[model samples]
Target: MVKLSNTEIRKLDDAARAGWLYYVAGKTQDEIAKKLNISRQSAQRMVALSVSQGLIKVRLDHPIAKCMDLAQKTKKSFWFSIV
Candidate 1:
């Protein structure tokens, strides 16, 4: 892999921001590319990197607990339980 310079790192950061603002935030890729003054492919690649780096996190709010009391209370609060 090519070592990135400070400038290039800054560029990468800009790319990351553009990617998150566009792809993850539901803005169009074209708009992101245009805003970043880069090609659409570059924008897409940045988004891919964001995911690969674990910067893009996807989660379900279900909690796992060994405590019976907490589990029972949670189950009572929520209609659907996933314990």
Candidate 2:
């Protein structure tokens, strides 16, 4: 298990939202956990917590093809890298 701070937990909350979105979109918990660099159990728990905590909304928007695109672009523009 990994130890996390309140801030880190909040970040994980965002991750939880993203992970839940992916899972609800059909990806497996293992896949989401792998992507998030955590355990499958953590992924499932966080995703569920996000839903239980009302941190995420279940909306069916057209898959935003530019979501990751904009993320990458913002990274480049701001010289902020993830990883």
Winner by TM-score: 1
Local accuracy of candidate 2 as per-residue lDDT tens digits, 13-64: 7666655656567778787777778888888887777777677666646668
**Clash list (residue pairs), candidate 2:** none
Root-mean-square deviation (CA) per prediction: 8.8, 13.4
- Compared with the true structure, all predictions reach lDDT values of 0.73, 0.74
lDDT of 1: 0.73
Off by over 4 Å in 2: 1-12, 58-83
